[model samples]
Target: MGRWEPDARGRLRAAAIELFSERGFDQTTVADIAERAGVTERTFFRHFADKREVLFEGSQVLQATVIEAIASAEPGTPPIETVAAAMQAGAGLLQGNRDYSRLRATAIAANPSLHERELLKLGRLAAAAAEALRDRGVAEPAASLAAQTGVTLFSVGFEKWLTDGAVDDFALHIRESLAELKALTGDA
Candidate 1:
């Protein structure tokens, strides 16, 4: 692959994940990723601030997708249900990338810093969901509770989706997790 090839950003992300998987996150460097991607260090910097950003670059898109779903949900929908649906909708963005997601997850899990960054990204998503709920006129505790719970559901569901070789639909995992939550709360 040439540095002038299309999808330099994608190539960089792929290279970063591959290097991270093969060499360990802490052992990998920007130069290594750039070399693997056949791009200059400047090109990598243009696409990502650091190696960690390669893994988290889609967080904003994920957050926006969830927020849009929440905001566009039918009026009068229950807060929890709205958030769950929003999360399920957000899951669509990850649908075709299970293998990539699995590798990314493994990389994050192996590094404490990456794990913390992942948690922070989830926290931001939750906060964004909460704000979207509030925009929908949901009350204080209800908005926060629903948003936090939705994020938890997404986290657990995503793990199940990653680990379950037979499951291919992320939305299904989210729905199952939501159902399990409802059952646990005696609301099912």
Candidate 2:
């Protein structure tokens, strides 16, 4: 087919991740990602603001998924359980993207800036979660604590899922992680 084909966004994301993994995030350019994606620089820019954004484009969606999950929960749901439910709901985002997720994690881990960006994204998710919890009538430190705890659980679960090639279900990893967290706290 032609060079400027369909799935420009997906192509750009995949291309950016591959290039970032091979050449390092700082060394890789938007033009390089565009070329690797078989598209033009304009097409790349249309999909992502910069190479850094390629790694974080899903942050908003992930946050939104969690927030929506929290909002949809029963009014009487406890704070921690609300957070856990939201986390499990958001696991759908990573469902079939294990290889890509692993590559993205590796790419982010290798670069301080990328790692910072990831932390910032997680912070945003936590803040959004806290806000959602507050909307559910949860007060101050408890909301923040539950939200951060959920983020921690999700991060740990994602790492375990990436490292354990045998695990195919991302949600299962998250549920297991949540169970582990409860066990650790003697709440299980």
Alpha-carbon RMSD to native, per candidate? 1.8, 2.2
Question: What residue runs in model 2 are displaced by over 4 Å at the alpha carbon?
Answer: 1-4
Per-residue CA lDDT of model 1 for 47-156, tens digit only, reads 88988889998999999999999999999999999999999999999999999999999999999998998999999999999999999999999999999999998999
Location of the lowest summed lDDT over 10 successive residues in candidate 1: 1-10
All candidates' TM-scores?
Answer: 0.95, 0.94
lDDT of each: 0.93, 0.89
The regions of model 1 sitting more than 4 angstroms off are 1-3
Measured on C-alpha atoms, candidate 2 has an lDDT of 0.89
Question: Model 2 over residues 1-188: C-alpha lDDT tens digits?
Answer: 24547788888899899998899988999999989988989878777787888898889999999999999999898899899889988988988899999999999999998899899999999999999999988999999999999999899888888889697787788889988888899944
Q: Count of backbone clashes for each model? A: 0, 0
